[model samples]
Target: MKKMFNYYSDKYLASWIIKFLDLIVVFVGFVLASLLRFNFEVAGMSLSKLLEQSLITCAVYLVIFSLSKTSDLVMRHTSFTDIHGIFKAVVFSLAILIGMDVFLYEGMDYTGVFLIPKSILIIQALLVMLGISGYRLAAKSIYATFLNSSSALKSNVLIVGADVSSLMTKSTLLNSSKHSIRVIGHVDNHPKLQGKKLDGSPVFQLDNVINSSFLKEKGIDEIIISDATLGPAQKRAVIDSALQYNIKVREVPPHEKWVNGELTENQIKPVRIEDLLGRSEIKLDSINIQNELQGKTVLVTGGAGSIGSEIVRQALFFKPKKVIALDQGETPCYELGNTLKKLPEDIAAKCEIVIADITHFRRMQQIFSKYKPDLVFHAAAYKHVPLMENNASEAVETNVFGTKNIADLALRYKVQKFVMVSTDKAINPTNVMGASKRVAEIYVQALNSQQNSTHYIVTRFGNVLGSNGSVIPLFQKQIEKGGPITITHKDITRYFMTISEACNLVLEAGSIGNGGEIFVFDMGESVKILDLAKKMIQLSGLQEGKDIDIEFVGLRPGEKLYEELLAVEENTLSTHHPKIMRAQIQPVVSDEVKVLMDRLHEKVLHGDDEGVVGGLKQLVPEYISKNSVYSRLDKKSSQAYA
Candidate 1:
């Protein structure tokens, strides 16, 4: 029977039937009002006059209802907006009817008999509104109750907030026929709301005593957090407590993510490890960044990669005159172009994608000559530690020569600012990738010393959470496969930040850097790889030792147990921004740097792997190889210097 009702309710015939029923209800309300006004004496009122008044009332209501389209709304999903529509239609229809009665009576009165008394008309309007609104509200209530009570596989839920968003979330869940989760109660931090009731559900204050026993007593199978006001630490605490009880935990995104200004059950998602990192939101100087980028032709290399693509997105926010995203990857660069094409017409008109390698000097020179970009963000480089260890020449060619190409062209084109993205691995480097980046840093710093129009800046930070080779995505894939998760070492750790945060700070650093300054971001704290793996397994609702196995493979070539942000010889000075600091290192002589780079470039071009490693050691004195084939060169360099 319910299925049949649902099927017919969606047909066009149902809408017309509802409209016809509404007219009959309005007509009856008018006649009933007249009977009541006459003290239940039908003889006191002329039956013909009452019938004529009923027709007029029904006609007016039909016109007004059509205009408001109140009958077009589904009865089962009716809300306050629908009720408001019905009220407006009824009041407007009666107001016009009263005006017509007064106008005709004053102008043309044949027998001096009134169509409807003013008091009767007012009573009729109220009756019509209630008749229409009450039925819809009752239908919605019945449907929600049926959905909640009829399900046999329902899971008891506890909401973590008692505010407006939580209320909406509960309503959405209750109204959804496909969902079987029943909200049992609310948990809030406010003492005043401890014993209060939200829609007849009791609210309890959260305390430290919450545990598996408390959850079991409440019969809670899941906890849904819908409060954006709670800090990360508080949310983490709730998640941790819920996880201990083996109860599923989910969270709603910020209000801005709601579709069409309405929350849906699908928007609730499981909590992620990034939420537990406890990093505060970054505050950027938008006006300063806009002033530096607006109406300027900007270029971002590696713009198809993670950090580079984010830099492109941020640059578009500043309304640059033209943003040229240059990357060597054909597929990703094409995808970036498609993404930009879907942006607002005005914003998309200002973006251009180029598939060109940064190592090709002639191609880069052409780009610089044609566009003459006013600002350049250099992010192209080979970054895999183990991969670069075997192919050291490729690392030098891309990280070193690629950066040098862009920096030189920026000088020749007289660009205003040049920002090179570096890594924390560049500090006291132990890997070929890091050493190559450090060498590029030295050259850019040395170039800044020469009289030039470009203000060269370098922003260095640690590992980004979901970048190309980051461990988070790898762990996620392994967990999905339900197999052994591999770790390089149990004690390995690295500083982490979101890609968005890192890019925002990079732009901030670019705006504030004068010249020859390496800006290091405050990457909150280093996370243990072993602990991260365990938390990931827990998040996936699997046991570490039983459901999944974590195998510790010894450290890879050129890999270290820890990463550094600053070298021993480099000291940092506080900057205007809280999260950013300036690294002050001994200046490199430009003449000496030029001679060494030329020699290193020759070796790299000739494919002399040994000579390239030898030149890298000579350039960066602190570039000691660790568990790599290049370790032999460290001994050779020490002996040569001695």
Candidate 2:
């Protein structure tokens, strides 16, 4: 019973108080009008006439206020909305008050020679409206204070880079009663702001804050770098500092979000794993994008996989006529289909899912004929290095033969474009996977050179972080199991990127490629595998050496110590997208190449693993089998062949 009374008293009684303030406004307005008509004198010329005019003004003000519903405007949060409501209130009040004055003077008060003019009524109404609006404005501030105090929430923030966005971030934090965050201080790269004040918080230099022994002693919680203009390298350095300090760091969304006016507190996210890779963001050309994919029927071969699914998401955003997604995996396909179903109705309708293998040439041909797709993204391939070493024939059959089947069908269907997803392993191959990939790259490039239509382009890059069989998720699972995190080798390093970033580069590649061009993404610096494991453990808030033990096993079969983005012979030519480059590679082909490839495919079909390896080595002379028991070509040939 007591709790119910408190609820009613707090809400219902407070509402009545606000309504009384509105009534006081109406009464005060008429009194001020009467005093103004009497030239500021206390005594009025005719008390009865003044009373009658004041009552009529009060009645008019009440009717307008009720119609405008001005008393119910207390629930607005932002000042902009309040200002809008105030404008409406003033306009409605003046309209009704002036209408009442004209009615009384022209229709009923003609006998009086000393009646009030309508112009004085306008001035008095304006004064009373300003007074009431001012009171409501003050009440809004008081209400915000009450709400903030009741919540007892504050976020502990340490801002980096004292830029304009930093100040805005501070203001947003202070204005919110929703989150429990507080700005403890600011950390800037520039030393000039060391002792400066921002929103009543002390500013400290970043070097002093992180390296100083006393900085962390002050209980500085989270750090935010609000400067969007910082270059990739600078941003990387700041993020590294945050990781070192074990404090979460935040960054703004990309320019696309900013230009769309999507600036908000929630849009700001913690610096992700990709930011540490230190790669520059890709810039896409809108005109080329629209010309290539908008409203066009397209097909993605490995559609349920990481890269393929991202392509489907991005393609649907462009409002394609239809997007055909083909994959062999059941679970991933079902998951992707489910996610697509949850998208907006228009986007959901654009996606079509098909479960099929690319190795079956007949099935791929039928799909092409059925959909008549304008473009195709070929991403299905066997990529695990050590696993491929054990099963070399399957790797060769899928990576080499699968690519040939897709290319042939694209030509048969006269598809406008065919993009083959290639890898850095193809460059100066030393493993079975790399050898097969190199062979596939040669086949596509050679096909593009000879073919008149169906422009064939290749996009090649190194490892992505969370792809199938990636080491990151493996390490995370091992850590969660409360034991050792395994690493193949302490010295091994590989170039890494996020799946989203890689797919965007692929899209940009497709937009810029003409024909027979190999597109290479600018992968950032290679990360040491051992260091990556330690950081992951630290991010989990566990001591690396004590709580979680890291085990360094010897290098696996066919694993390279360092992955390269380009072959020793290939050079890069800059394209319109800074992060994408056109590889200056020579396409190797001969008149008898088709017969040789056909014979090789037959060997793969007949389970002749030895013959397939021999033919693959002969086709791509750069293929050097390393750390494997498989047969290598007797003669060492320096010339790179098709």
Candidate 3:
């Protein structure tokens, strides 16, 4: 019997079986309705006539059910919509029967006889509606019970929101046979919501104090946060308390991300370190961005890169005339092309992917001349500090010369706005990559000062969380390998932002910049790399120093224990946006800087690494190299200047 029940309970088979059962239920409802109307006496009614009427009613109900497609719904996942569909089918079927009875019985009454009474028809409609809806509800309950019986272990989870997202998440978890989670209650921050109930789950107020003991006493195995409005600090506090109580923490994505208007078990994920950054959500002036970008030809250099590609994606949101995604990497550029192709036809039509190196000045100039882009986003550069320390020539070629090439082209082409993507490393540089970028910044800022038509803007921020070659991916790889995660220094720290946040600021800066301005993003607080690694290990459900060891490999060449966002000589002025600030620094003499840049460019073209490094130090007096072979050059430049 159990085996047969299980076989019929399968999702596909259950739907068909329910349809067949519904037909039988309709016939039975008519028979019972007739018996009730006649008080179980058949002396006045013809048995043949009653059976014929019952068969006709069943046929009508079947036709209505088929039209409504109520039987197509998965019986185990029956929802209010399904029940509503059943109700509509029953009501329509009853209405059609009433029409037939009013006409047919009028003619039969002339002969002083009736086939089926109107009272029985009404009673049958009520009974049929109840039977169909009740069967589905029963099926859903049985399926849930069977699943629970099959699983010996189930986690008691508390959801952290009382809103629609939390309800959907709870329903999805409960209905999914794949997950063994029982929602124990909901916790909300609203005091007025205390003692309320959502779908029979009690709502409890979470005071500012997170008592781990109290949560443990409730047998809460996990806490799922489905509220998007919950701030990062509050989320972090909850996670900390849950961890102290040995309860797992998960989060449901915002309602906007729900699939097919319903949440799913697969969508819930473990809380990430990025969620604890506690930075206010960035709000972009999309109208302003759209006004600037709409119907304009925009060129994005290094569009295959993490930050650059994200900028491309966001730019599409503004409905630009064309986006020229230029990159030198053949594979990444091709992959980007494929990704763009997958976008909606309208959006894909606006994207043009090109493969060309920014260092190739002639090729880039040809592109600028062909497209005549109205706005230029220069994101192409060599950014690895240690790698650039060894390959200073490449760094200078890409970071310094590449930027100059794009900037000069933008000016020559009369591009309206030019936004350069820079790094926090460019501030108080200690490495070739940082110093090269600083040189690029100086060149662009100085160039912008000379330009009247082209408005040059520089947006600088720290590390992006999941960019290619970022520390997060490296740690993930190490964790997957079940071994030591390497950190440069025990005290090393850096600011991190998501790729989306960085790109949004880039677009915002592009729109708001009138002229030469180095826009700095508020990267919240710097995070210790050691702590980040440990948190990642714990989030992976591994004990730090036991399951996964963290090894301090000492600082690499040109690496620093901490990163600075602003130089010693620079200060910041507020912008309209809270997260973005403009750096106020001594203005550069464009002509003098141009002469120096010309010299630096010539040396870089000739592969004179020492000359390039020396020229950089001369241009930026604060370019002090640390743990690098170029330290001697810095000492020499300081002595020479002194």
TM-score per candidate: 0.88, 0.73, 0.90
The CA lDDT of each predicted structure is: 0.87, 0.75, 0.85
Per residue, candidate 2 scores C-alpha lDDT tens digits across 135-196 of 77565555545544555444467777677667756655544545646678877767677798
lDDT of 3 by residue, 1-642 (tens): 556656765636455677789989999999999889989987987788777888899889888888888788787787766777788899899889888777777755532233456799899999998998998788788887777666669989999989887887887777887767778899888878888899899998766336546687788888889888888778888887877766788899877787755677889999987776646678899999999999999999999999989899889879899999999999999888888877898998898889998888899989998999999998988888889888878899899888989999999999999999999998988888998998899988898877589999999999998888999999999999997999988999999999999999999999999989999999988999998988778777788877989999988889998999999889999999999999998888888888777887787778887787887887877878888888888657433421
- lDDT for model 1: 0.87
Residue runs of model 3 more than 4 Å from their true location after superposition: 1-16, 32-47, 64-74, 79-126, 149-152, 208-212, 254-259, 638-642
RMSD of each: 3.6, 6.4, 3.4
- Full candidate order by TM-score, most accurate first: 3, 1, 2
- Worst lDDT run of 10 residues, candidate 1, spans 4-13
Error of 3 at 470 (Å): 1.4
lDDT for 590 in candidate 3 is 82
The lDDT-based order of candidates, best leading, equals 1, 3, 2
Which candidate wins on lDDT? 1
Steric clashes per prediction: 0, 6, 0
What does the lDDT come to for candidate 2? 0.75
